[model samples]
Each structure stands twice: as C-alpha cells, then as structure tokens.
Target chain A: MPYTSDKPPLPETPEQLRVRIPGWGVDLDPADRPAVPRERFDPGATGAHWEFPERQPEERPRERSIEHGTLPPVFGTTLPLRGVSGVVRRYAYRRFSEARAAHWLLLMAGDRIDVVESRVLAAVRGRPDDPVAETGVRSEVSHHGWSSRAGAGRADVVHQPMDPVIVAGPWVLGGLAAVVVARRLARRARRR
Target chain B: MRAMVYRGPYRVRVEEKPPPRIEHPNDAIVRVELAAICGSDLHLYHGLMPDTRVGTTFGHEFIGVVEQVGPSVERVQVGDRVMVPFNVYCGSCYYCARGLYANCHNVNPNATAVGGIYGYSHTCGGYDGGQAELVRVPFADVGPAPIPDWMDAEDAVLLTDAVATGYFGAQLGDIVEGDVVVVFGAGPVGLAAAQSAWLMGAGRVIVVDHLEYRLAKARELAHAETYNFAEHRDVVVLLKRVTDHLGADVAIDAVGAEADGSLLQHVTAAKLKLQGGSPVALNWAIDSVRKGGTVSVVGAYGPIFSAVKFGDAVNKGLTLRMNQCHVKRQWPRLFEHVRNGYLRPRDIVTHRFPLEDIAEAYHVFSAKLDGCIKPLVVPGPA
Candidate 1:
C-alpha cells in the first residue's frame, strides 16, 4: 500500500473526542445512563448465546506439536461463519468462527471495556431468531477486553463490527473516578 | 507559458512551466495539434488517480504534427500528421507479442500485470499527458502511426482513445452475429461500443443511460436502441421482455465513471432513482445475460470498491472480461476499420472548444450540459 499522507483532521477537545470515540453507543452524558460497574464484570455473562459453532464432523483433529503449537480441529467441507454474535443482541456481537489450518489466535476489542462486555454477552446469547449462528468464549478480560489464544490455530469472526476508538482501558474505573470528582466539586460549590 | 500540472485532488496549476524537451534517445517532440478532454482524464482532475505526482500534464487523447524526431526514429518525418495511440508501449514486449499492447512491461510496469494506458497514473510509467501545446512521445518509432491523408485531425483524435476503447469493448464482449448486445453507459466510450457492436453484426444493440440527450445521440447517431435507465427502472425485466427473456449475449460497461456517476464525487447509487437499488444497467447486464454469456467492463470506477453479490455471478457462470484498452492491440485494426468507413468513431464528437475556453468545456462536461458526448480541445489559432 502506498503511504497515506492525507489524514482527516483530529478533534482538539475531550468533548470532541468523546463524541467521536463513543463507547457502546453511549451518549456523552453518562450521568443519566445505566453504568456497568467494575465489580459486575462477569466472564460467564455470555449467556445461552455461547455455543461451539457447528463444525464439520467428518474431519479429524490434528496432533499437537510443541515446537510450533497445538494442532487444529480438522473438519469436513462445511464452511462456517467466521463471526456470529450471541442470541440476545441478535446481530450485535457478530460472531462466526471457523477451524484453522494454521496457527492463530482470536482477538476481540470494543471501544471500551463495557462495550466489550456487552459484545461478549451478545456473542454468548445466540440470537433466538437464527439458531444456526452462535458465539463461543475462549477467554475473557475486563480492561484487556476478550481474547482466545487457540494455540497456533486460526478462528474467523463474522459480523464483527470494527469500531474506530483508541481507548486506554476499561470505562468503569474511569467513569467512577469522574463521578467521585464531580461530587466533591458539587459539595465545594454548595459550601461556597 | 505554464502547462497545467495536477497537484492534488481538485488541484491543478498552470505556472511558468519548463518547456518539454526530448528526454530519451528514442523520444520525439510533437507540437500537439488537437488534444481532446477524455472521460478518463477526469480521474486525474478529481485527484482520484492514486500516486499521481505533481507537475504532470493531464491530457492523453491527441492528434498532432511531428515537429521533431529522434535520430533513430525513421518512421515519420517532421510535419507528418499523426495520431499517437494514447498508450505508450514498446513493440517488443511479451504482452505486446500476444497482442496485449496495454500490458507492456517497459512502458507501464504498474499496470503490466493487467495492462496500462496513457495519462492515467504514475503506476503507468508516469508519462506526462498531451494536454499541453507540445508533448514528448517516448518509443516514438513504435507508439505513433501516421494519420491518413484523407482523415482530418478532428476525426483522427477519436482513434487514440474513445474509438479504440469502444472497438475493444465490442471485440472483447464476443458480440456474436445476431446476438443482442446491451451497452451500459452512454458516454463517448459507450457510444463507441454501441457503434462497434452494431458493426460487429449484433442483431440489436441496446444502449442504456439515464441522460435523455445521450440516449438521443445513441439513437440518432449510432442507430442503437436506447433505454433511459433513469425512467426505466427494471433493466433485467426490460431486457428479458425485449429479447424473449433470454437476456443479451454480450454486455459492455462503457460508461465506467462517466454516465454511471463513477467519475463524480458522489458514491455510485445502488439504483438510479429511489425505485429499487441496483447498479442500473450493470446489474441488468449481469442478470440479463444467458448462463454462458459474456460481460465486458471497460468503464472506470472510482475509489470505492463496488460490492457485488458473488452468488448471482456463480449461478450464471458468466464470463466477465475487461481490461484497460490495450491501444497497441486494437488501434491498428480500429484505424483500418475507420479508414474503411465501417467504424464511425468520430460521430461521438458532439462538442469542440479552444484551449483557452477549457474551463467552460469542463463545466459543460461536468454538468452534462447540452448533450455533450466527446469534447475536442484545439490548443492553437488563439
């Protein structure tokens, strides 16, 4: 690819940044919104939407090698969706996975941790309307978002919406810290 | 006088430009006699052409007189009236031998994988266009052919691009005898393709375009059955209804970015109006073709990669073919056709303007004003 010298102009202020890199469709005014508390982080929040994607039964699993990585689950000629989201969100966390012929890892991220968790939950809860598609959990992390390290094996995700956001970490801690500071300032203004 | 050079998207300048000198040993300088504004030329003006460096003159199609020739160039003498093939290619490349002159490696390395042409982009060897008063033709001995004594400069200009491309489209589409052909897009290329298809023995040549004037031109000048895509929403149904539901054997996309709005700033619409979203005639062509039919796309598309549902293509088993017209392969044959009176490529030249009034010409072409098909630009006698 040729080097791109043209870049769209960037936002200068935090308000502008928030408007641009919005997490989980959450509005900038978080005070009126339902916040996902840090303590409520659940690895199993994936619900019933989480199911191993239908794999072709005819193919045999490969033997593992220590030098390279673990062997992949070989399947018959069926091509599965790479991205399929959970049942509840229907098309939210588009989740689709296919067994790999080579080493690979599944990486997932949201604009923020809350958004990531919501996507994970959506992936777990298979869309009731379409039972054929389901999302499976390989691993979960709050701030790190979700990742499944299938030793040297590849997995493709379908319906995976790529959000343009450069987040530092989870939104819960950041939101809670801001809330505390705002309350203190309110108290000071009341005293004045 | 400064020559217009493309700086960036929508950016062009005519500064105190240096005189174009003969750069290579085989290069010959020709004072351009008649250079025309081509639809392909718009790709550069819009800054959509990738990697177009600054200081490149931006016209390709030309009819010129040989002012000077290199020591080794014995093919044409000075004052010889010639029409240079828009694409510059050495006569001795692998592709050139295979009659695929557009893909010549030495002239256009970037597009050599498929094929290359002139005044397009840097990937095509970064050769400056013929928009200026004088142009340097590299590989002069191989790239240019003399204009016949009977043919005028105005008539000869079309041989370089529109005529050649249209002829190529007809040949590539495999328009069989008595086959119904639908050419989508009514720009200069589309008009040329329609004429070529008619000449190549197609029983019916249906030209589809949204503009009424262009459709009128197709009917009046090219004698093609024209369809107003804007008024007629159902191209597939219409084609099927016209051809006993068998669709067309050959479908050519000559409109490219021009009539299809691919060259404009707007994203290509799924539907022309709000009726049903489909790529107008292209979709109809895809659906209207028989299972083993051929579809030739010579139109230029913009930056946005078009999303095509592959399922329809698979089921039809359609032989989709296209290439940037290899002027080297078809030019001689097309030139002969023109000479024989079988090909009337010059019929598409609806407007001509002086070099000083180029901006007005651009406005007309850009706005699709006054039934403009092909606008020829004469640089001198101002």
Candidate 2:
C-alpha cells in the first residue's frame, strides 16, 4: 500500500508562492550572492516551516537565573517557603533540558559516544568565551520535526529530525487509563 | 590517542583525545584499522549539517579490531576483527525489530528526529566516530559482525556505510528489468548507487554531475552514461528528451544539502545557510522522473526545512522513498555480492591519508583536487 500523510505536505503554486511561504525570496539559484540580510534569518521560519511559533526573546540568552526553590513548609513554614519546592523542580527540569541540549560528551579514543553532564561542558566552554555567542555566526536554526521537548533544546534539536508524538508511550498509556476510568465511572452511575 | 576534530567550517585537525572506553553493557572498543572519508562527511566539513559541534569527530565508514568488549557483548569477544554498521541501534525498538535499524529509538536521545550515527555530529547521538585510533561499538552483539575470512578490511569498511547506502538506494528504486535509472551526483555514494542499479537489472544507468573528473569516474567505475549538468543549459530537460520525453523510470538523488545549481539558489541556500542546502538536485529528480515513478533520496539533509517541490511530487504521484540506509539490513546481500565478485567496494578509494594529515585530506577532498573520489584515512602514520 502507498504511504499516506494526514497532514498535507507543502503546496505552493507558482503565483501563490509569496503568500504561502512568506519571506522566502524568489532567488534560489546558487551564485555569488551577498550575505543573507540578518532580518531574513527569521526564527519564526515562515517558508520551510509555517506551524512553529516564534521563540520567546528571553530564551535566546542563556543567562537567566533559575530560581531554585525548596519546601518552606517543613513543619508549617513561613511566607517565603510557599511554592518553593515547585520552583526547585522547575529549575531542575530546565537544567536537565540544558544538559540534554549541550553536546558535552564523555569518551575515550573511539570506544563509544556518551553524554557528560552540562556543568562539565559549561566549564570547558567558559574558557573560550561562550562558543555560541563567540562564534558570532547567527542564522535562524530552529527546532526540528515535532518534538515538544525540543522547546528548551532548540539549539540542539534544530538540525536533528523529530517525530510529532510527545512522550508517546506514556501519553498513550495515560489516555488508555483515562478511558478505563471513564468507563468505570459510567458503570457506577448506571448502577446507582 | 589522536583523532580528527572539527575546528570550524573547512578546518580540521588531528588532536590527542582520550581513548574510547566501554560505557554500556553492550559496548565494545575497537581500535580502528581502516577508515574511509565518506561524501556525506564533506557536508559536515563544509558546515552544511547543523549541530556539527566543533569538538566532534566525523568518520562513520570505518573498520577495526576489537580490543575490549563490555560484559553484555556476547556475539564477538575481544581481539576479533569486525565491521560495525554506521548505525548504533538497540535492536529491540519498534523500528529495529523490523530491520529499520537506522530508525532505532533507544540509542539516540534525538531519536525522535534522526537515528544514532557514530561520529557524524552531535545531531547523531554525539558518538565519537571511528576515524580515530579507537572507537566504541554500541550494541556490539547486534551491530558488529565478524569480518568474513575472504572479505578485505577495505571492502568491509565500505559495507559499513557508502557501499551499503548505494545498494539500498537502488533497492528503493523498485527497479524492474529493463528499467532506466538516472542518478544525480557522481560522488562515492552516487557511483555506488549507479553501479548497483546495473546489478538490479537496469537496462541503462546515467550519472549526472558538473565535475568532469567525477563524471569520468562515474563512467569508469559505474560503467554507465555520464552527463555534465554544467555543460547543458537545462539538464532535467535534456534527461527527459534523452529518455524519450517520458523521463527516467527511477531517479535517485545522491546529492543532498550542498547541491549546486542556479546562481541564486546556491547563494541563498549554500552560501547564505538560509534553507537546508538548495533542493536543486531533488527538484531535478522530481522534474526528471516520469509520473508514478520512484525517486530515492540517499543524500544527507539537515532537519531544517528546505523549499522542495512537494506539491509537484504529490501531483505527479512520485513514490519519494528515502532514509538513512539501514546498513545492517543490507549486509547479507552485500556480503554475498562481495563473495561473488560482483562488487569491490574498495575499488573506489582514490586517495589515502595518514591520520595526522586529515586536515590536508579534508582540504583535498573539499576542493575536489587531484581527481579525488574517495579517500581512506589511516589512524596512525602509514
């Protein structure tokens, strides 16, 4: 059987090219062309990608202080302690995302490819001035495919492929569980 | 231990790096004996692939002798010579279960997008590659097969990637007897694909490339017709005319992201790094293939969007099949073909460089200098 996709593939008529793929310049021939105007590097990626939303400005510079919080209600604590644990968890999650996005690796010669912690990569990157900004090369590299987890790791996932399914295995299981719960509730209501 | 590291675009250097160690139960450390620089690696060299981190090494087509095996590695013991597929698959995922090892879900954290590839870039699971003195083979039991006594190391290394990918490209064509196949790109993989198409009962095969040297090599190695796209005003139109105005029965796009075409497309995509390298070759494939024909893409493209003629493809009903070749699935047939003398994968190697001269090797290959088609890299002074 031929493969089919529910989400229609890209379609741009010769005349409607401008309307469909906004910002995609007509010039596609490869020649000695001038540098792409900086504004042309739209993080929004209108042409090749139309569905992805623009990234928040705050996410660009990786210097935001993560407000790591802790539980203030140890034995009924003070005002400052409220929601502290949740904040800590959120901070931890962001750090985890950063670590995943970081290309820091642990390897000997050629034995294998494994990831090291983000802090270790940060230390190495610190010496050379943050390599990202230091390279001074800016292009609208964006998240790939359909990875929601790619949200914070946009730098890493931009070039990689991704499936649209999110936490697919667990998400499916949760849906199944909800269906079962709903069925059980319906049965109880009938009995009552 | 020393290995090639990506310093920047068009810059590479051999540097001392820690040797690979077994980090997983199924991992095995192999001391690389022979490594071939692949055409796709050029994409990395030219800074086409995104997330090609500076420190990352970039050799996927390689062979070596195992020096150590982790506890769970049972198929091969230490001190065995083996060929590892470019793919690092868990062998138990939904994709791997069906022989689509290239789409293995467990190995690469970015598996949602691309499969785990050894030593291409951080996009490929950040696995250090086999261009170094040592490399770790993950899922060693499932991925690395012992070298057949008759197969040469050079041929075995090719099977790991280029040769197999080419063969797979032909297979994707669904070629019937007397089919006319046209391959765009005369690089190593393109040459291999064209040659393999002949093996698949193609009555005619044509290779297209701008470089006279590469086209000559394609003619010589693939024993097929060659077309210099640059010499013609519109190569696609010429292809249709030559194929009786019906277009090719099957078209394979061996050139991926860094394709050169019209001046403006090259500037916007290749030079500007705006969209994934211009979809020139792919568009040509779509334009040159007959309605209801198959177009197989083996070229390496970054995940970023490219402005391809998807609408045309849909309207034409072209069966556009492509993937990073599942190397392990192609192994059985490749081995038989090698044993039967149907293929000599090593015959494509045109240059050899010591590990220390990798920078020069990269430069030579990148510049297309000295009629270079494929170059082999030795891990040590050779």
Candidate 3:
C-alpha cells in the first residue's frame, strides 16, 4: 500500500508552498529522480544516533589565532556525504514538512535501501510529540503501512550501520552495475 | 601609566598605561568609549600572532569621541564622534588611488597577507589596537568614519569588521539582481554576506550553518532561507536540491579551514598533514556553485600550506576570488546604508558585555552560547 500522511493536514505556509524544493517537489526531474515511496521505511535493525562528541575543556590553552590559507584536498572523497542516518533523517524531516525542523536523527540498521524508509518510520511511529512533523504524510491512517511500534527496542533496533545511508548512493549503484555486468557475462558463457 | 601589554605568547595584561598623544601630522588621539572584543583580536589573545611586539594595545573594533587631531586632519575634528577603519590606509598610495585601500603598499609593505589593518599583526602592519582607553589613529582624514548624530555607537560598532567583511563578500561575488547566493558558516561574516547580497539585489539568499539560533537570526534579519548544515551531511547536494539543480550563482566561504584541520596545525606539525594553502570549504563552495559560477573566500586565513587540487577548480571552470576586504573603498556606501536604515548589521548582536566582564563575553562568543552572533564589548559606561 502506498504511504499516506497520517496526521491532520493543514495549509502550507506561503514560504513552504513557494519554496523551490528540488529533488522532492515540482522541479524534480522524473527521469533521473527516483519515486520516493510513501510507505514507512523500516529501520529493521540499525538504530542511528546523532553523537555530539564532547570537546575536551581548554583550561588555559594557547590562544594564538593563525592565518588559515586555502588550497584544496589532494585526495578527498568525491562523495560529499559523511554520516548516513544524518542525511536520511534530514531528508525525511524536510520532505515531510509537519516534522519538527530540529535535528531528528535517524537510528536504524537494515538493508541499505530499506534503512532509508525505516528511518522515516522510526521518526513517525516513535516520535509522537513531534509526529515527524510531516506536511502531507499525516492525512492517511496507515501512512507508513505499519502502526506505530511501541517500546520497539533491541528486537528491532541495531547499530551496525551507524547512519549507513552515508554510503547508500555509491554502494547501491556499484552493486547494481556489478550484478548487471555479471548477468551479461553469464549469458555469454551459456551461449558459448 | 602602562598599556595593556602583550608580554609574549599567550600573555597580555592591563597595566597602568601612559596615555597616548597624537604623533603624526594627520593623527588624532581619541578616548575609546566602547571597544568590543573582535574575533581577530582572539589571534593576539591566543598568542597566535607571530613577531607581535609586547606592550601593544589590542582592541581595534571601537567607537570614540575624537579628543585631538593633527594639523592636516580635516574630516574629523576634536570632540567629534568617530569610528576608525579597521583597515588603516594612507588614502594616497597607488592601491588607495584605485580605492583598494586594504592593499595600500606604503602603509604595509610587509603586510603581503592582508593589505594592512590596525591591531592585527606584523602581517597587518602591526599597529597597536584600540583596546586601551586611548588610541591614536593616523591618516585620520582618509580612514575614520564620523558617527552620525542619530546613530547609536553600539549598533555602529559592527561597521568596522563584520559589516565591512559582508560588503566585501557581496561586492567580490558580484551579487546582481535576482541572483541566488549562498553564504557558508553563518557567523558574523556570513550574516553580513546575506545582508550585502540582499542589498546588491539577490532575489533569494540561502545561509548555511550548524547553529539553529544563528540560522533563525539570519532568516529573521537578512531575509534569507536558512539551511542547517548539521542536519544534512551533503551540503552541496542539499544546496543543489534547493536551487533547482543549479547551485547558487555565487557561493561565499566565510569559514576558512580544512575539513578538520586548522592554521596552527599546519604551522607546527612536522611534515604537515597537508602542504598547499587550500581550504576544505572552498571545494564545497565550488561544488555548491552552478556552472560558470564564482566562489568568493573572504574568511581570515592563517599562514599554512595545505595542498589544493587546482586541477579540479580549473576543470570546473570556477573563478576563485579572495582578498582581505577593502573597507575604505566600500565604507562610504556601507555607512550610507547604515544611515539610511537600508542595512542593519546590528541585528546579529545577541550578547553585550562590559569590558570588565571580558572573560564572560569571550565565553559566550567562543561557545556560541545563546545565539551569540556579534558580542560587543563596552569599554566604559554605555
């Protein structure tokens, strides 16, 4: 079943409606852009956490400010993303306008593709007060195809991925290419 | 009386300082009424400034009533309210003749780094700052902007660095009507960048930062669309998402550090981790820009060589422009903007502290506590 908004819907603010949301909205180039499934994404096992690392206290550290110059990275990653859950949660909240705009980190571990949807479900099912603050997602009863998970902990949540979505794009694309090429080679070998 | 002495590295003291008197023909001795702790001043505070002479006064962002002036001084008279240009220029050199006062070679020959400025460092012409009760400003006619009768000194203090830097970014980026501009690092410079971009006719401006309070303020004050970088890992992708597949026409990097490296690390670390002077955000800016776009880096850079892949920038056909803001050239227009109520850089100030409470002020600014954007230091009674 296609996912639908589960909350009481209201009119979008002028800013929200006029906002030029690229990949998610009217400007989305359908050929290149994937259809975002409405069903609740299940974070089957991985639970992502936004870790705010504590900075060591500087008691009386030297305060010399230096002139930082800029060149560019010699061997930096072409990929721009870093944390996985961070990006997913960011998109989930952004696409679903009703969700609180604050940092709602996605915590999930599952199949790479599944985790994306799961993270949004995690935000919706568990985040009752904020209700994932989605715009149109709240209009339907079973927006995620699954009722809210109650006390869903260890059995469902895991942490191996640590925001696995960071590598989702490249990893998924690379695997698909490998499978396609492998199939072609297998077909040639069978014909010979 | 002794001045607040910069004894050595990591050492400065407010000593019983002798009062300064006008020295040069165009000099003016002014009693500093309000001197704020500047982000640049933190360089001297942390003893990061090299070859910095001890016993030098250190505050530069200040407003005061001119107490005395030299024979040649005409623009400012005694008892007139004024604020000195942080970028102290001769106002007559070849560079100054072209309105590039920040690059006045005569005032700062060794200052190949930044044209020249008061209270910065040897690289900035090594003049003492206004942190002291009294400061002597040279080339007074060409540099200081007279405070208007109606303007509040507290609000006007920002014109010194923050607003000037913003104007510089907007000017260099060539902000035009209906343009989309993105300013990275919503610090004072970024906020100023948004304001200036709007003033220059950008149809939409987006400010990216990790701090929510600052983003809120940027949205409220600069009339910009704010993005929380903390929320998205791929800033370029997120920005592209917002700008209809074409990134901002101009992207300004107000933050000037490697991804996780700093100027100090490059200076001291044996076999420096990186070897060319490149900022990580510059690459991000490049990626965040649309085709044939420009990236303006106006952030204060420290002396360090981190390797930058020039090939990528070149191949991308990106035009990277950077310079210490030429304040003298743009100050008149900026000040006019302030006078006419067309600009208000003061909206960024979330905290104000007395000079006596210096430590607390630093704490708030450094910690970014409570939406602290611009922290003003009141040297004396407000």
Give residue B157's error in model 3 in angstroms: 1.3
Off by over 4 Å in 1: A1-192, B11-13, B109-116, B258-281, B302-304
What 10-residue stretch in candidate 3 chain A is worst by lDDT?
A70-79
What is the C-alpha lDDT profile of model 1 across B78-143, one tens digit per residue?
A: 898888888776555444544555655445322223334555554344566777788777667777
DockQ, all candidates in order: 0.01, 0.02, 0.01
Ranking of candidates on lDDT, top first: 2, 3, 1
Query: What lDDT, from 0 to 1, does candidate 1 have?
Result: 0.55
Query: Candidate 2's error at A104, in angstroms?
Result: 18
Q: Tell me the tens digit of each residue's lDDT in model 3 across B155-208.
A: 678777777877678667766555678988777888888777765556677888
The top-ranked prediction according to DockQ is 2
TM-score of chain B of each: 0.89, 0.98, 0.88
Q: What TM-scores do the predictions have?
A: 0.62, 0.69, 0.62
What docking grade applies to model 3?
incorrect
- Stretches > 4 Å off in candidate 3: A1-192, B1-13, B257-278
Model 1: how far residue A121 lies from native, Å: 54
TM-score of chain A of each: 0.16, 0.20, 0.17
Model 1: residue B63 alpha-carbon error in angstroms: 1.4
